[model samples]
Target: MVGRGRPPPPPQVARDEGIRPRRRNMEDEENMYGKLKFNMPKFKGEDDAEAYLSWALKVDKIFRIHNYSGAKKVAMASLEFEDYANTWWEQVVTLREEKGDPPIDTWEDMKEEMQARFVPTHYKTDLFNKLQKLKQGTKTVEEFFKEMELTMMRANIQESENQTIARFFNGLNYPIKKIVEFQQYSNMVELVHQASKAERQVNEDIKYSKSKQMIRGGLWTPPPQDRQALLVVQ
Candidate 1:
């Protein structure tokens, strides 16, 4: 019976094996944290609402890309705070403790807290006003579309697909809008696509007209104040 079984590993070998997995896990965590910190955007508690919104958007993107848990997302984002932002976070933690409220552990909760502190109450109203007045102006169709989309997002607008399409269509330049208005579109994507095509066609038409003008100009031989000189050369 004694000869049938193998002896256990030495104490040192057992300890080394036990430490290896833990060491690997620690290294992995460190590497992940390093990457998160590297990619995270720093916030300095600016008075500008748009700046805060922009930082929030960038941080949200980074968290989504990493698939971070709520708690981890909050933790990683807090690390990127700077100057007044860092002080604000510290005050938030203290205030929660004083009120006996649990620390903010979710990304959504953290965002709300930050927005309340950083974004002015008038920010959304201003953004909405700007959106209402937004027009294609001199911007390209794509640029105008992007501005509209960003404004809508910042304003936290919620609307049906048809409504959004209508808004976008209405903002288009008159030429493009007139052409696109006749087309049927079921969604914003289709509307944008049609508008873009119309824009290209409009641009081509303008180019063609300009080219024709240039050709006409080049072909004209000034009705010669020198008709006599012209006749002599002939």
Candidate 2:
């Protein structure tokens, strides 16, 4: 042939292969943002430290569900700030810029900044005091465990597994603790399960004892001779 043939067109599959992953990522991001639009909670800058802690916990849960990157988490959380909280965040960002400090890009850094700004210095101390005084008392094991876990999270307290197990065990009611102490427990979960089981057993025993008392009080009758003697005395 006298003229050179045109170069063959690039393969369609090759062109699409590069775009497929990018397109998928874009779609995933869209879905994540859509969920966040509805699920994200607004922080109103309440003076109560517990309110701030609860908001942080809820935001953290959503971030975990989406498995967002640090930058994305910070960005998404900041979007939900309202009123005084939003103003505070803006001021903090401006100050960092003026001071030549690096931006808060990570969720941990953002949380630290927020905690410093919004939470009082006495918050952690108060949480610790409350935790130390926590007891199961009339609460169910599950209720007590939830309260303890929430307090630890809010306080940012760290303890060894054994320490956690011991704390949970010691907080249990005497009857449940008495039964659970002799059993082996390597973790808080195991200790709670054992303590819950012991509580159930204690309750069943109390219920059964009451049933027996009812039978004796309501169903049993004195012997005929005893009844006759009592009638004569009367």
Candidate 3:
């Protein structure tokens, strides 16, 4: 009765303590979702099927979360802009045109067709060959490892932690391989982290060696004429 004299605290403010105003809440939800754009990469067909399928699944999930169920129209629109092979795209277009009113009716059908066309039946063999041929040649340790990871994914190859460590060890360059082997790390993750650090150290040492040499040589060689004259005098 005493607090009733305070005029019931304004209706808007009295509704709830933690609840945001309705319009503001809607705006917040919009802001959260606005950052999510369907930006999956274009499918180039074959050899690129896994990457495209992964991207497609993620985009489809986003649409489902936003209550855009089925999303057939949106999915087809997205596919339209992808860089699928020209002949393949033309074939799909021709089939759709001849089929009837709605062309491909569902995203599921489109996905199935795309998978059949592009996903390799024997990725394991290719993946194995890639892993076998992989080397640290001309690549940094991280780059080589990343390449291996991609190949593993495409191959659907799963290895134990020890196997992973061995796989990576097999591919490492000589000096780094020798050092990492001696360290005897049990976990592949730690092994990779240490390998990256060792790679950085090795690179730094090489760079330092080059810098000292350049400093000793004054960073410039005498021109051909001067070198020839000096050689002749000598």
> In candidate 3, what residue range of length 10 has the lowest lDDT sum?
68-77
**lDDT of each residue in 1-234, candidate 2, tens digit only:** 334787766556775888999999999987877576547889989887878888998887777657678998999899999999999999999999999999999999999998997899988899999999999999999999999998998888989988888788889999999999888877778888998899999999987876786688755355699679979999
Clashing residue pairs in candidate 3 (N, C-alpha, C atoms within 3 angstroms): none
Q: Model 1 lDDT vs. the true structure?
A: 0.87
At residue 197, give the lDDT of candidate 3: 79
Clashing residue pairs found in predicted model 1: none
Residues 9-74 of candidate 3 have per-residue lDDT tens digits of: 545745555565776898888777867666545555546666656766665665554644355544
Put down candidate 1 lDDT per residue, 1-234, tens digits, no spaces.
Answer: 335578866556565888999999988986786576546788999998889999988887766656568899899889999999999899999999999999999999999999999899998999999999999999999999999999999899998888888788888999999999898888888888999999999999987876787688754343457567878889
Which sections of candidate 2 miss by over 4 Å?
1-38, 64-73, 96-103, 218-234
Please report the candidate that would top TM-score against the real structure. 1
When 1 and 3 are scored with lDDT, the better candidate is 1
**Where is model 1 poorest over a 10-residue stretch in terms of lDDT?**
218-227
Clashing pairs counted in every model: 0, 0, 0
Candidate 1 residue 149 C-alpha distance from true site, Å: 0.6
- Stretches of candidate 3 off by over 4 Å are 1-31, 34-67, 71-110, 122-124, 184-186, 204-234
